[model samples]
Target chain A: MHGKKLALKITSYCFLCLFSLFFLFPFVVMFLRSFFTATESLAIGSGLIPKVFYPKSYLDALDPDFLKYTGNTVIVIIANVVGKPLTAAMAAYAFVKVRFKGRKLIFYTAMCTIMLPAILTMIPVYKIFVDLGWNNTLLPLTVPAFFGGGFLNIFLTMQFIRSLPKDMDEAAIIDGANILQLMFRITFPLIMPVIVLVAVQSFFGAWNDFMGPLTYITDERLLTIPVGIYNKFFTAVSPLEAQPNVQMATGVIIMIPPIIIFCLFQKQLVDGVTFTGLKA
Target chain B: MNKNTKYKDILKTGKTLAALKSNITGYLLILPLLIGLIIFTIYPLLLSLYNSFYLDYDGFNNYSEFEFGFGNYIKAFSGYESKLFFKSVGITFSYAVIMVPLGLVLSFAVALFLNQKIRGMVVFRLIYYIPCLIPSIVNAIVFGYIFNSEDYGLMNTFFASIGIPAREFFYSASSEAVVTFAVMSLFGVGGAMLIWLAGLKSIPQSYYEAATLEGSGYFTQLFKITVPLCTPYIFYQLITSVIGTIQICDQVYVLTSEGGRDYSLLFYGVYIYREFQRNNFGYSAALAYMLFIVIAILSAILFRFNKYVYYEGDN
Candidate 1:
């Protein structure tokens, strides 16, 4: 048994080390790409690990769109922070705490909506936005968040609300606390962790969302980071008709703000994933 | 006894009405959510379902002019779109094949490494998570340079240092395209790592103590104990991954398939997306619905395996 244990430990260590390297290699490659030089490209041996390091990749990435893209991303994020979590929390509070006629039936119907793939709704939703004349506006981008339309948010809020003790709600009701008061005063404070979860998630969802902004926003001035990155690489009529390195530099810049935010909230994020029944 | 009886009797006459009041609050609570659902969601869903059954193209114009029938489904599954449908199904299948198992194994292994009583484990976990938060558009750009035909890639330089010939990793079966995607997916393994960590936390320390007393070593404890306990976690991650990969777009759409590589990187969701982009809405909805069906059927099959799962504390 002792010998077998020793062999197993070694195998576990070996497997773990190999896996870490596998997961780490792409980041390693991304890091190296950030440092590559044009001088090395002519070296016939110029590698991603530069013999000469230049800050220019970072420099080049900070273009005219840098501020514009960053500003747009920030606006959406702020809108999402205010809109997504609060709406979802209230809605979730309703689903869990409130009891009404046909309540279960209605909740079940909403839950069934969870399985309707967003891809299926893309065209019709876009058409609705277009017909409403909100297509080029951030209204299309940020408005649905106000009502807990994103079921994932609703689900997370449900989990948080489900975990709270029921007695507090009973006491509040005895004290004549309205549903809104019970939510804002009692339930919301208790589910702070989930609120944090929803905020961080909504921020990232709005931040990293390429397809949403791509499908909806067509104006140059209103371009979000994801769309900005694409425009940098794929712009047809521009003189810079697609240079890979410059585009990557833009990628480097685009990745930074969210990366920083994720670092700060990685703990909640991990917890949030597990707590929300992510696997199920 | 007096207070209890009085309290109980005080509300007796109004019991049904009070119950109705609470229920009304519940209805009111969900009112906003229901409204949004009807407008932004259910309405759109019905519209898509309606659109899918029609013939709508330039030879057809827009929604105002299109004729409704089973013609769209016919066009979708007919011989003309058969190759498109099958190719998409095949591509999505290949993608899931590479992604689901790969994500599970990689996430498991990385989770184990992080779980180890290693120095700086938190920082190490954080380092691994950086790529996941970078967003796919950024990921695509950086990788495009890293694998730009191997002529300018870091890997090529690394290979040349070892006397190996420079290779076009993308166009070849050593397929840089797939490699890029796999790399991108690895970054998002943070979610998976957390699940494994939760599983790790849920394990009773007493189990390890007992194993040690029986002269079992670390490996026996891990494989015989930790890994088995973690099977449920592994199973969950695998299922979500299977579903996620089926609807994958955006990363491939905004990233690679842009540069005349249309036919090459043509994924199922991406193919459907292009149909929409080209104003081929009818065709796109059909494909999206098909994806939904495939996902539902497969998830049901996987979910059936849930009976075998041994969740702790159930007994």
Candidate 2:
């Protein structure tokens, strides 16, 4: 029995190592590829290691246009990070807490949006964005998030809010606190972890958002990191000056901020996403 | 005494009115989201339902003037493109089948390991999540390079070293390119792992501690307690996995041969994109709506899974 247990432990560790490597391999390839110079990179192929740690790729992606793209990404993410959750939280709070006639119907309409898939709305939404002449700007990226509910976050916040004892409101009212004060002081503080989780999730969503920015923002000056790297990586029918090293660099650069964010909040991020009291 | 009673009643009515005023104020706070949802989200969804009924000779030019009819819907199923519709749907469903379960299993394994009380936990967790943060296009491009056919790709070199002949892993995923498709899917395990890590943590210590006291080994504990308790996260991952995979076009589009010889790896999202590339917006929209319907229907079906789901402490 002891021998059998020892074997199981060893096998588990081996499996973990193999799977961990499998998960880590692509990023290693990405980072290693980013370090090889153009000629050396083209020659070394997709080797596991670089013959020389050339740093030119980073410099290449640091162009004026690249900075502009980063700015564009930041701008779009800021809009979404601020807009999406505020919209979702307010909508969720009102739905779960506020008592009103037609509340259930309106909330259901919002909930139904999640399963609809963003595909169905693409053409029509794009058309309206075009008609408003807001297609080229970052408006297309930010504006929709402001209006829409992140069904997941709203559901999360709703769960969090539901778990709270409603007696807090009665106590607040006894102290003559209004609804705004109720949210800001009493409720918001209680649900800070959920709020942070929603914010970080939104940050990741907006930062990694490609399809919206790809469809809407066409101006070379206004492209985000994903769009910029995409253009450099392929010309589709024609392979114009493909820079694998530079593309890797851009990928690395674009990937860094979120990685930092993830690492910084790793503990919270992990625990925050756990279904604390969720239905299994 | 009567005069005092009437004054007290008046004071009570005034307090009741104040409560009603706060309720209206709550509505005011949520109004922007409602307005935006109506203009950008709600109306467009309704419009898709409307347009799916009518084929506009000039839907783009005169959408407001178009009359509603069911010709488009019927044609969608029995139209010339009906076979294509069914084909895309089949491709999407199959893709979801492979992606969802595979991602969940891989993620669960990684999360289980990472959740251990071990050294270098942070580094492994950080490294594992890196790919999820990378743009999908770049993931495709890098994988594209490694799978590049013509004996140049990393796969060909590695295979040759093992005495296997150089195979075209990208040009056509035939039997030769199957490895490439599997590898492509592996790059996305990070997203699921992060969520799984979250799930692993939430498996309250009581279950494991109790299992230990009962002398059950780790595997039994894992199978019985960890797996059962983590169903919420598993279900969440499964749904998103299905959604992501159904629209699995970006990597295929960015990485493989333009013609993608034999077209074995041509997923549904890529096919719609190809249509769009060919200026077939109407067809693309039609195709997209088909996916939308599948996702909606699947989710609705899964909503029934609530009966099986185990909410903690409920028993």
Candidate 3:
């Protein structure tokens, strides 16, 4: 029995290691190739490691045009990261603590929007933007975020708030705190972890959003990273097609921020996922 | 007695006024969300539904030429462009059917393994989940290059190293394209794996201990205790994955140029996008609605299985 158990453990480890390799292999290749010269990338029988490192590939990939795109992406991300958590928390607080008629109905209505796919509303939203002359501007991308950014964020926040003991609220109320004061002073501090979770999620969403920029931002100057990368790599029949090293380099650069955020907040992110799954 | 009655009336009115004030405060708190929902969600949904019945856009006049009575829906069903619509539906359906089950099983298995009390497990979990952090566009691009059929492609080179013939993946036949896409999507199973892990952790260890005492083997315990207990989570995953897979667009949009060879990879989302690009807004709206209905039906069917799910609180 002991020997069989040992064998099973070994088997499981082997399977896990193999699966990890599969998940990590593309990233490894992408990273390694990002430092390779244009010719080395295409050379036949070349080993995985480059013969000579070309760190300049990063610089070359982030030319002036790409820099502008990166800047645009940063603006969008900042607006989203700040706006989503702030507004979502407020909305979640209202749903959880504030008493009113039709509260459950309103909350459920917001939750139901999660089922309505974005593509279904793409056209009319686009028209709305056009009518408001908001196309080609960041408003089309960032303004709606000031509202409850996503139902998921609000719902997660509500769940977190619901988990907290109601006695805290009663204590604050007894101490002569108003509704806003109770929410902002007491409940907000308590749900900071979830707010961070929402911020992280919103940051990633804004950073990686391809369709939003693809549809709304028409000018080349106003393009975000994803759309810019698509145009740079995929759109043109570029002479750089042979130099996929540079393309990979661009991808690596764009991937860096999100990876850093993930590493920095790994615990919160895992906890967030666990919280969503278990609670839901 | 008159003075006392007047005082009582004043107290009653004060209480009513305070209630009204609280109600107003509640409304004020949720005002931003209410406005957002109306503008971004509710209005757009209604407009899209209305637009689905119209045909053609007058770009100069800034109005959609109305074609009443489901003309756009008919076009999607029986018009000349219906070929692409139907083909995309067939492709998306197969992709979802294959991808959802494959992803769930793989992630669940990974979760089971990771749940073991092994050293360096956190590192393994992070490594597995790193792919999920990468953007879908970047994921698609990286995979596209890796699976590129040409000479410099990684898959072809690896196959060559092992003395196997290289297969054209994305450029291959329809069935092959579906499999290739599904396989690429499996790279981001980390999210689902995390959920599964949470579900696994939530199952009480006492159940396993009792099973062991009763002479139940590991596999028996897993099936009898762990699997049944995790059904709620499994059900949740099923519904979400179904909804997500039905609306998949980004990867297909990035990987394929001009809708792949003979539009073989034209997914429903991509087809809707193309219709919009062609200024066929009404037809695209109809397509979106059709996709929505299909998702709704699939979700309804899956929700039926919720009765079998075991919740710990129920007992």
Evaluate all candidate structures by whole-model CA lDDT and list the values in order.
0.72, 0.71, 0.83
- Whichever of 1 and 3 has more DockQ, that candidate is 3
- For B245-289, candidate 2 gives per-residue lDDT tens digits of 777765666565232665556667766666555544555666667
Output the lDDT of residue A52, model 1.
Answer: 69
**A-chain TM-score, model 2:** 0.91
Error of 1 at B7 (Å): 13
Candidate 3 positional error at A214, Å: 0.6
Regions more than 4 Å wrong, model 2: A1-11, A44-46, A165-168, A236-240, A275-277, B1-16, B56-59, B63-86, B173-179, B256-263, B276-281
Residue range A1-280, candidate 1, lDDT tens digits: 6998677667766765665676566666556655655444434556556676766877777777777888888888898988888778777887888777887777777777766667888778888888888877888778877865467778887887787789998998899988778888998899988888889888888888988888877787888888877776666563234644455566666667777777788788777766665334
Cα-lDDT of candidate 3: 0.83
lDDT by residue for model 3 over A1-280, one digit each (tens)? 8999899889988988998899989888888888888887776556468899998888889799889998998899989999899889888888877777888898889977877778988788888888888886888878988976788888888889988999988887898889889888899999999999999999889988988988877778888888888888777574357367888888788788988898888888877875673434
Model 2's CAPRI class is medium
Clashing pairs in 3: none
lDDT of 3 at B185: 85
Give the CA lDDT, 0 to 100, for residue B93 in model 3: 86
RMSD to native for every prediction?
Answer: 4.0, 3.3, 2.1
Misplaced by over 4 Å in model 3 are A1-5, A44-47, A239-242, A277-280, B1-11, B58-64, B161-166
TM-score for every candidate vs. truth? 0.88, 0.89, 0.95
